[model samples]
Every structure is written in C-alpha cells, then in structure tokens.
Target: MKEITIDYALRATWQAVARMYNEEAKQFESTMAVGFTLLSIDPKTGTPSTALGPKMGMEATSLSRILKSIEEKGLIERKPNPADGRGVLIHLTDFGLEKRKDSKDVVMRFNEIVKQAVEAEKLQHFFEVTETINKLIADKKIYVKNTTNH
Candidate 1:
C-alpha cells in the first residue's frame, strides 16, 4: 500500500465528512443518519415510506430504525397515502422542517467552503472522475469474470 488507491481516498474522505456531519448534528441532539433521513423526505408532498430506503441508498432495516427513532423524537409522522391504500407517506412535522433547514445549512456550508478552497476546474474534474467511477460500477465494467479455464 505504498501508493494510495482510489477507493482508499474515497472511503477516507467520506468517513471524514460523515464524522464532521455527525459532530455538527450532535449540537441539535441528532445523528448524521437522522439528518440525512430528514433531508430525504419531501417537505410538502411527503415521500412514500417504501421509497426512502432506495432513495437514500440505505437498507430497509436501517431506515426502519432511523424512522422509528425520528418518529419518537417528533420529527416526522407516517400517514396513509391516499394514492395507494397500502402505502404510507412520510411527512415532516413542523419540528422536522426546522431540523431539515439546519441540515441543509450544514451541507451548504461544507460545499461553500470546499468550493472556496478548491479551484473551479479542479472541482469539476473531481466530479467528473467520481461520475465516471459510478458509471463504471453501474455498468458492471470494473470486474469481469473469465469463463475460460487454463
């Protein structure tokens, strides 16, 4: 591991960002996951409960736990979705809207600072590289299996 790998860099940077967000969320007695969940819900129309997991790239069990916790905190409420009898819509309570604003501000501040520190061209390149990586993985181009046996 003399030379850093792309995955190592991405993982390290993500972990650092997660840690920073969690720390900032602590002031409001919340966690990064909760803040993220709050931001994911539609502020006005509400989001389908089933959609939250996939929308956040999170598993159902983890999202269920977060939803329960936030529900207990009075940040959100689940209501019957009129569009679908069996589906539930997750709506942000008034308190949740306030917290969502805080989360948005925290994220915006991070982006603002990063944009200020990094040159515009470099930042664009960074985004392009990440997008390429995502596309490669999505297309299953990174790891191909050999069918021929030697």
Candidate 2:
C-alpha cells in the first residue's frame, strides 16, 4: 500500500466533481464562474476589470470577450462610470441575478453533502488547505501548475 499524495488527491477530487457537473448540468462551468464572482462582487461598485482579471484566473482581453458574450446573451449589462467617464461597471441583469440564486442554492447543497460525506477532522483539514491555496493564488499570484509528458 502507498500513501496518496495531496496533489493526486486534489486532481482526483477535481476530476470527479467536474465530471459530475458536466453530466448533471450544461454550462455548469461558465455559469458558476460568473455567478460566484458576481455574488461576491458588490452590485453598486461591481469589480474593477483590473482586479477581476487576475482574481478570476483570466486575462484582460479574455475576460472582456467573455463579458461581451454574456452581455449579448442578456445575462449582464455594462454601466457607464460616474466617477470616471472612460470606465464601465459590470452588472448582472435580472436574468443573471436569477441564475446566481439558482447557482448559490446548488452550490450550498453540494457543499452540505460533501460535509456530511467527509469526516469532520478531514474536512477541516481540506478546508484549511484549500483556503491556503486560494489565498496564495488570490493574494500572491501563486499557482501550482502541473507539467507532464503526454
């Protein structure tokens, strides 16, 4: 018997969850990405494009394209900045807000089930580890990239 490395465990976990999401819901990835970030952002201020790009693991141009597509689909709208005439604020439309509600519910239930399935101590460990990783990525821009020969 061999001990499983944390990286292996995380990869397995992500793959399992991603597969489940793919099978259960179409657009799960994109919807959750926008929905979760929008939920975190202030509707009044919205998030600055400069801050949002790196925080969301997206490049500025890529993020812009995504926003444009989403806006065209009627999920979001851009508002002119009052303070800075050249700036624009990203905001969720009614449809986007509704999707956020649904996404939040699904995520909450999924988290609850995971909590029940995992032992308390182990779950706490996972929480700490994930939080550490998230903070590292968010605050320090550190990402663990795996490069392997195919």
Candidate 3:
C-alpha cells in the first residue's frame, strides 16, 4: 500500500513471525532465541562462541544471555576449542539435539505453510528483494554522506 513502507512491512512481518515462534517455543519451556541458538550450534563439532553472534545476526549481549539460559537448561555446553585454545565451542547436549530437531521442524512447517499459501512468483520476488536489501547494506549503498558544506 502507498501508506506502508518496506522497512515497516519487514519489521511488522518479522515481529509477527517471532511472536508465532515464541508462542510455539513456550510449549517446550523455551524461547525462540534459545531454539534458534540450539539449531545454530553444530551437533557434531560444535560452534565457536565468536562465530555464533555474527552468524545469527545477534548482538553480543543478547546472544550471551541466550547462551547462558541454554546452558543452564542443559541444552548446550561450552568446551575449550581444540583448534583454537582461546575460543570456546558450544556443543549441543543430547537434549539440545532433540530440541534442535523440534526447532527445525517448526521452521520447516512454517516454510511449508508459507509455500502453500503464497504463489511461487511472489516468493521468488520476495527472495530477490531481500537479497537486494542485504546487498545494499553490505555494500554501504543504502545511505550516503552529504557532500555539500552545510
């Protein structure tokens, strides 16, 4: 609509999706962030603490809180990285792996539902638009400094 902006639409849609996931997560006594973090951690080799935040597009403090909660819940454990002595790797517990499977199913179910509801062309366009937005930000082309002397 002419009254709505792209950023607004994106934010609103994401918030709704997050709410949906969180509600579902509540059934398992977990939050969406925890489920997402569970899904992010590799089951076999684990993931570095440093890479987790960037990979998830999460801030350090937010990710830290989520990790702490997950750890307390016995879903994940941190171990010294063999490759890098200074880094810690987050490994999923057996319980964490089970929860991660649940998370993946939930996400896949959402995707399937969306696929059924939306046209393929529209979904393709959505992906293209998102790609363009990401590229613009990555390339620093979304905003430019004013060159003229004020």
Please report the candidate that would top TM-score against the real structure: 1
Clashing pairs in 3: none
Residue 71 accuracy (lDDT) in model 3: 92
Best by lDDT: 1
TM-score of 1: 0.95
- Cα lDDT, model 3, residue 86: 94
Ranking by TM-score: 1, 3, 2
RMSD to native, candidate 2: 5.8
Tell me how candidate 2 scores on lDDT.
0.70
lDDT agreement with native, every candidate: 0.97, 0.70, 0.94
lDDT of 2 by residue, 1-150 (tens): 299987788899888876655454465545445555556545556665556676777777878777777778777788886777887777777877776676677778788998899999998898899999878877756755557767
Candidate 3 or 1, higher TM-score: 1
Root-mean-square deviation of every model: 1.8, 5.8, 1.7
What are the per-residue Cα lDDT tens digits for candidate 3 across 18-121? 99999999998888988899888888999999999999999999999999988998999999999999999999999999999999999999999999999999
Tens-place lDDT per residue, model 1, 15-82, is 99999999999999999999999999999999999999999999999999999999999999999999
Deviation from native of the Cα of residue 126 in model 3, angstroms: 0.7
